[model samples]
Target chain A: MAQTLILEGNEGYVLSEILKLSDAQHPTGYLSNEEYTKYFLKSVKGVSNVRKTLAQQINDPTITNVGIIVDANSKGTKARFDSIKSTLTQYLPTVENWDYVASSPAGWVADVAPSFRVGLWVMPNNKDDGYFEHFLTELIAPEDESFLAAQEMLTSIQKSKNQRFPDLRAQKALLALFLAIQEEPGMSAVTALRKGLLRHKHPAARLFVDWYENTFTLG
Target chain B: MIEHLTIKNFLAFPELEVPELKLINLVAGKNGVGKTALLEAIQLYKCSDKIGTNRLISENRKGNIIHHKDRIFASKLEINNLSMTMAVGDYKSKVFIDGEQVEGHGHPDDYPNHEYEFIRSGIKEHDWISRRWSSFVLTEKEELVTEVISKVIGLNIFRIAVTDQSIMVKIAGAKNPVNIKSLGDGLMRTFQIAMALVDSKPLASNLIGLLLIDEIETHLHHSVIRKLWKIIFEYAIKWNIQVVATTHSQDAIRQLFYEAAANESYQEKVQVLRLQIGRSGKHEVIEYPYEKLEFMMDTKLEIRGL
Candidate 1:
């Protein structure tokens, strides 16, 4: 059986690392906007492209499970989740007769027709208006005291008029600075996770791991 | 255009339904999944000469001239408000208009006059190509075909002439006209496909033409498939013809998608249908409209079935 995890950007590397940390088998396939450069889904003309992708995946007989991961951004977790739900509702084959109810916390898993499951998770703990970087920031190991320093520096920068980054990019700037000071400096989020720089047992991390396990239970 | 098709007891398909067929539909599936059978079903349904169609289908399959056991072929087609259903068996054949059965095993006069051309895979017979060429020579359609060959295959052709034994093309600056067969298999296949499309012109302005091609990528190079599809799309729209083609080549599907997506008006006129045999021993169809096809091509997903 083929299972896929679709991400909005190049977050597959980080998600792959997290799956390893959780001692879970990685999904059979991964799709992200990075691979779709010509028809990127982020563009206005490509807004409904995700729905189109979902329609094809849902019809594939080999695919038994699918997981969608996208940022909440300014839309908030509820709006993002609702948008995904709408897409699913519109594209799911009418023959499947899929009936979905939101799961606890901020994720959903539905048993569709012909023996397949679909799951959706909004980023940043699935409750706040943030992105993958915000979720990554929450995984900073408690013993890493430099994280607090990074946060303070970012807060000061936000208050200053000279701040170059937009308010929406605060989490990304903080994570970058924090990673810059690590022992293996300038490593990507995935490499940092591999080196045990981020705590896998954090509460936010546990919620996501639980969602993944429940969504893709193997035979 | 035939918007939907239903088949029962036709070839290997016990029961199947395909919906939302567009102007240009590409059918893809694994071997024995009945890609060619689907084309035969459409041809059998549209052909007014049922006896001749049955003989052609049987000859194409190389099946026995006479069946030892009874086999039934039934189909239901929907186009706009018109609905047609036909069931052909060993003993008798029946055709229905809307829901009422026509009298006397359904005469050819009872059916709408729609032109049909079913082109099989591989090199076509020389006589068939010559005959198709004979119909279009010295007509406006002949110039259209010549221009398409010139633009797509980069061949400078002054005219196309049919000899007693072979069809020949007069290339510019050439001493003698060369035989079309000597121009290589790609050009010959392109010539056959182009002729099939042009020959399927409807006799009446209100009638529609149907062109069913099997394994359209048989002798086409990857580089030429895109240009060939461009010609197909242009001709299909210009002539008000509906095209249903089968292909196993990923390049064929990709190029078709790119060509369709490049034009705004052609975007909605293309679709891909995937046929698969379900675990229940029944055939199933999955449709990928323009948007879904675009997404699959963009993400490099496997649109061809296993």
Candidate 2:
């Protein structure tokens, strides 16, 4: 529980993403059987019952117990970290802290709201255990030619950048260089993630993880 | 060519669905058994948009929206032999066109999409009603009277409701000097009828066209009624316009059948529907052969309400 995990912060961001995604009425809200049938079954009748279930799930105690704590200015783990320690004291029965989950103030309200929050479920390409990922990619990827091209450009650059370092050092070096290149003006979003990986130098890597965590933990 | 129409969705009678009709249709009901309602629904279906117009100013207004809703039935008016399969809101209602199913839209909006196109005889629909209207009375504001025959031939006309009986349809032109009240009520009614005929000149939708007149013998002497019937019958025959009017006057009915029986042209063309709506809330539109409707008044027919 005391151990620090590098990907844990990204996992927090994904959780936040999952909550936001679930916020819309489509996936998890008042989808009555009769309404669903009328919408899809071609029958003429009123539907009820689904709206309340979704409301209850959103109001449930489990997620309420899983509170999040975010620290804005850390000064490399100084009073900011102490503030986190202080906040964690009051948020009990919620795992003593977000030990099992990730923390970031970003998207806090969206994650807490019922029937609407649908956040990060799984990591992209990493296939990591996390929030569910059912976003625009499923529908747009099949038809969007531009998105396919951009995806190709990003992976190609990531590959070329990876080859610049030895195989053993490549994983760490790649992200650090990609992060730096991403900071350039008018940078492609795909390149930004790759360049963000460039900050994989131990200190910057720690920071990259923190940035990802804040995105999900802080609202 | 619907001879009769009957509907029963009133609180007095919950389940009565027979619209007994033949070549000559008649509706007879006391005070109110949804008699006028049945008539209005048919009118709404046929000409809802024409409920307003400037063309009928010299005549009389129609297009009256009358309603007395009950908690039981939403709207219960039995349609007979509707050819169009109307799609209203959520239901696909069937229509019998001379005992045959009409393919495509039954709803008025979908009328244009139906395969059956009602192409008029070399007359642009726009100018058709207007052309016919040219022959009608168009009085100027200064009370001058002139023929509107050319103006009404090809133009879309107007609609009328029961409440519209008092309003002016065809009016004096801007320069005319005749005051509308100066004319007798019978004259005003005649002007309304003429305007309506022009309004309904097959220039628009081609569904069944019926000119409904309630108490046609209104505000006129027996002689005037006879004269009016002759003119109405002639107009109905010439334009293929169907007339389904209600009247309590035997003198009026007798004169009509007498004229038709004596003349070959009036024999099969002129019709009368005997209408009777009872406390049961159901209406009966007994189609009379020739003008037997004129003789039904003497018959010992016992209608619950009437």
Candidate 3:
């Protein structure tokens, strides 16, 4: 059976778009015939919810492998990794060995052992403290000057407001505003990506896409 | 309490090993899927000495007990302080404790046919059932008997005594005192379980090692079974006892899930093993956790097979 993929929060939209784009680019049967090679994606409300489900998932024999996606906001990559590590170890003591993959400037993926190869990706990349928006910001397609002007305008607005909004939230708000300015307007990240408005082919986004494909691809 | 159990060449099971057995385990499966055989094997290992081989063979239907491919049938159970092994075949039914031979395979005439009183099943005679109630009344353990009776049977067994010919008992709703035999099978089943569980100085404490029942939902309503289960669960935890019972009723399992959901720990303690015949004509055991079972129950899946 195909292994289960767990994502933190309601990140299903972004994940589904990524999987759709990857399948179109790499024509793999893993996502279609789930019993043999397809990956099943599931998202819990938050990290604590993931902890609870992960505790039970480790004991479930049918679930061969697990993939987790979380934001490494504020708490650095190691702290984010330890949050899941403690829960996994408490439930399954046999878990050992860790391979940290440096996928991007803000993404970090760890391959943990003991049969269930748990892969963790902390956004925006492996070395920094940021959320999904921080990673999504890197996929703004460098040549889009209108989005650049929109980012500057939002930055000036935050400055005028005495920087009350957090840096991550400020950037996310700018991104959301820019997405709303699109031809369709108010479309989610996934829908925008499908409409060819979001740069799913950007190198920064491709790093995450490749990491996801490689981690879940069956031998 | 039995912490682990393994059976080989026993009925439909050629080799079966239940490694992570909890205190309150429920065996569920389709008909002729070896659910009863599993309980029978456990009883043979623990309570067989009480009822001799002849009675056991007759009631347990040991003629077809062995697997078709294997001649030697064996079972191993790990109890609180003892490890027991039982092997039955043409050589004879032999029982060993801690690797030391305790009983021979042949049926002995003089050997006490029955000893400990707690082991009882729907197919077994009630005369050999636990005499805990009689002992309770005889020794003035009325408080314990009445307390357990009301909790398990939902009827106040205020009066109980041994007559010259039989045992008489009176329930709160009944018109008058009647023979315990006249109370009906459901009441009888409840009484046996309650008597074995209720703490009384007259009965042996260690006899509460294992509670094995085939089709535990027999002769009982879903609500009554749930109530009985609540009492059994409390007593089982208090006495550190392990319960392994089989049931084919979805109502029985619905009540169980309702109970487990109430007490969170009970969910972990309850292991539902569903046995099904695989394509190879061998029995396959599928274990469902409480959460998974609840999902199935909610989705109205057919958990009970044919």
Candidate 4:
């Protein structure tokens, strides 16, 4: 049976983008009408803003989590987060909110299963994708400036290079960056290097699994 | 209130140690060298006690602190004056607090952090005294007040920021605003420090509290940094609050010492500890006299910062 989830966020595109990176059997899904009413419309932001329809696909019940990506720019984001958590706290077989926003920090919504809620400030959406290039060109690919530029365009959109996002929170971001590279021709030179770790196999995925087992204690 | 911090092998810089520190300790290091990691360690150190060592070990072992494999185990964390020392590793962990054992994890208040404990605490103490001493982390500038400032500092703050969103409580020129997030980072941080001073003391009494900021200077012009120093020093004298913070900005480093020398109270009480990533990836801390930092900032030697 396929698990399902209802994602909550301000940007549908970012939520959808994160769904693409999840790489779970049926782990990708969006909010249904019931969840939209319970999670979004009833919330304070929904009460204030227009109710725009979002288009994201839900595959099967295997999708156990939902990403709740938001930008730091939201006016009452803190309050809104509380609202989301509270709304879902009551659901039977509840789902967690995941994140896929750029420049934001990664957090888990374990009610369903662990996921991230990425944002701009947490990640620092500077230059959209420049830091990856900076890290690649300067740190990873020092000699080749142009090639680094390509990676910057294809790199994971996390926040400041100065700040570190725990390895546990990096699963979606790293997976997304990999998929983005596969879609673009600019990063072919670096593809061979990355392919050393098979994409479908997800060697990088272990970092997060280790995190869940270590950090989150059993109730 | 937090007396001291101690860290043991978790990731990088095994056996990293420090004595009881002053109000403001300036930590500087090369990029990817662990400046912010030190702050995270401190937050984890103190917060672990409040939350649980299980979360602490897991949070670290998850490989988020060092960005390496999650196998950086075999570690212990403790804060002096407070009893618990968190021993972290794979399969087994323990948190000994005040001579008793405890379980749980994450920020001391709540795992999954149900609510913003900092702001909730700020709101509880939002009466008269807290208005004077103001302190904050200046990442999103004005929004610091909205998102964190208003919460930790209180709703009465002239500013409030949520995530990246910030709005100043006071609109134009007014006596004071409800939220402080509307202003720039420098002004807002000063406001938090000032408010904290006032709230923690009686009028005209010197407040003996610490101000710890990750980056001492954020988004302020050099001249403005000087003015902020003047304002904070005056507040400290009037209210009797000790200021402790961190900064990588040369402008902030210079202004703090310059203002300290010009003001006697600061000269007597102020201390600046410089943290550097030494040759072996270990942290080397050097305490600089006001005059020494002044000279270095003037020379403008390129020093890599976290």
Candidate 3 chain B, which ten residues in sequence have the lowest lDDT sum?
A: B107-116
Report per-candidate DockQ.
Answer: 0.16, 0.00, 0.04, 0.01
Give the CAPRI class of candidate 3: incorrect
**Considering only chain A, what is the TM-score of each predicted structure?**
0.80, 0.23, 0.82, 0.28
> Residue B173's C-alpha lDDT in candidate 1?
89
Error of 4 at A26 (Å): 62
Q: What is the lDDT of residue B112 in candidate 1?
A: 47
Interface RMSD after interface superposition, model 3: 9.8
Candidate 1, which CAPRI tier? incorrect
lDDT of 3 by residue, A1-219 (tens): 336666776675686676567663322234354422223555666677667656545644445566778877788888777788888677664556653444444343344544456767787776688778877767777677758877887878877956667665776887787787777777688877786667788877777777676566453
Candidate 3 displacement at residue A131 in angstroms: 1.5
The best candidate by TM-score is: 1
lDDT of 1 by residue, B180-222 (tens): 8788888888887877777776665655677899998888887
Give the Å shift of residue B52 in candidate 2. 12
Task: Give the lowest summed-lDDT range of ten residues in model 2 chain A.
Answer: A40-49
Model 2: per-residue lDDT, tens digit, B1-306?
Answer: 443233233223333343333322334443444444444434434432332112222222233322433433323222333322222333243444324443322344333322111111122232443443344334231111112211222212232111222333333243333433354555444544555544443434444345666666666667666666666666556544556565655666676666666676676665554444321223434345563433332221111123
Residue B209 CA displacement from its true place in model 4, Å: 3.2
Which sections of candidate 2 miss by over 4 Å?
A1-219, B3-26, B47-177, B204-208, B277-282, B294-306
Off by over 4 Å in 3: A24-39, A82-97, A101-115, A161-165, A217-219, B1-23, B26-45, B48-242, B245-257, B262-306
